[model samples]
Target: MAKKVWVERNKDGSWDAFGDDGAHIKFGHGQGLFDPGDLMKLALAGCAALSSQVAVESTLGEGKGATISVDGTYDDELKGFASFKEQIELDASSAGLHNEDVEKFKERVQKHIERSCMVMHTYEHATPVSEEITVKQ
Candidate 1:
């Protein structure tokens, strides 16, 4: 079973997310920069990194440890208050992963991320936001 995840939105329009007793993550909400909404693409990249490992381990059988790192590019033009395009670059070791196998992993990770990446799915379809304001006269 996966660990529980929780997030608390902050005053600067950022959100802090915590997972299982691990380090907390702060997501920013900037227009031209990385924002809370942008987490979708990053989530795709991140999940792909781990999923690639899963696919690798399952295929190659257990041996030494392996890892994958992913980075993404989000088109600023299309990235409005809503939609955007996501591109991911994956890096891995050559021992357990051949060039063709790595390519396969990339494609597999992309497909799986589309189905399971929460942030992407949420933003791509529906976004629910609520604002609380206190005024002084």
Candidate 2:
């Protein structure tokens, strides 16, 4: 894997971060397209998506046998701290899987991906956070 890198901000309430693909993600006293909490949700959803893909391929097989997609949303009241609603959804199709099997996939996602998502775990456990930002100028 590539090096894990991050850009940060000073404690006055600011942040600086960039995506590996060269996308800028920043925050300052409440700015930017995303925040810590939002990122966590995204991470959980992303993990679920990837894990589901892996699970589907392993369980069902590959080569035009099945197609899988996932969408996720989380409830703010459930997650707490984060007011924005997060919901996760899944869209899948398979030539070999019946409706029952699809349901099984959902179960697997609920049991494995949703349950094991790193961010989801963090949110469920309520982890502590330490933040600091220092200005360059």
Candidate 3:
């Protein structure tokens, strides 16, 4: 499947991004919308969180009381993200998982997320982006 988004520059120097699902986001200072970098961070964190949650639910039979936190730094020199870290916490006792089971579950979940997260995979293996400009007469 393929997804597409449209971004249009407004006259006031702001921009609006329209998704295929009728969702839109405004971008610019004072626009009350997320900037591009913020959106990237959100995507990375959200992917990790969702993947971890699913893994937890499937492995532990429930996902209650599980929390995932992700943080990273954008490197201008490298033109990419750096120092990405994700922390996942779960109350395995409530889910009836023993200590060994908890540790095994955490390891397996982390591995699955690292392998399955699309954003993380893209960040690791960045693809080249190219643009072509067209002028309307």
Candidate 4:
């Protein structure tokens, strides 16, 4: 399924993004909202965290607790992201899983998340983006 959003510039030089579900997100340098770079980092982190959570739950059953921390390095010279990292911490004792099982689960989850996360795959594979602009008089 394809999703779409509409964005328009506000009078104050900020921008508003509108989704089909009526959600609104404001963006600008001074709009007190998330800027483009911030949003990009957020998207990446959120995707990784969510994917890791799913992996952990599937491996250890539901109610298992885990924490995922995601970080990305922005390259100012290249004007893009340089690298990304994710740390997944699982509560194996609470889940009552053995050390060997936890290790295996962690390894499997890591591999699956690296391949399954859309945002992470895009970042790693360097997806191409193109834009065209038109002026109406």
The lDDT leader among the candidates is 4
Candidate that beats the other on lDDT, 1 or 2, i.e. the better one:
1
* Tens digits of lDDT, candidate 4, 25-98: 88878757888877777777777666677677786678664676667788999988788666767766656777
When summed lDDT is taken over every stretch of 10 residues in candidate 3, the lowest stretch is 59-68
lDDT for each residue of candidate 1 in 6-106, tens digit (9 for 90 to 100): 88888877778888869687776665445654565566555654544555455545652234333445566866553455554443554468779877766
- Tens-digit lDDT track of model 3 for 1-137: 66688999999888898988888878865567667777777777778777777777776676353566666787999886766776767756656777798778878878878888898898888678999999999
The most accurate candidate by TM-score is 4
Candidate-wise lDDT, in order = 0.60, 0.59, 0.76, 0.77
TM-score result, candidate 3: 0.73
Q: Which prediction has more favorable lDDT, 1 or 3?
A: 3
Higher-TM-score candidate among 1 and 3? 3
Worst 10 residues of 4 by lDDT: 63-72
What's the TM for model 4?
A: 0.76
lDDT of model 2 at position 62: 61
The model with the greater TM-score, 1 or 2, is 2
Is candidate 2 or 4 superior in lDDT? 4
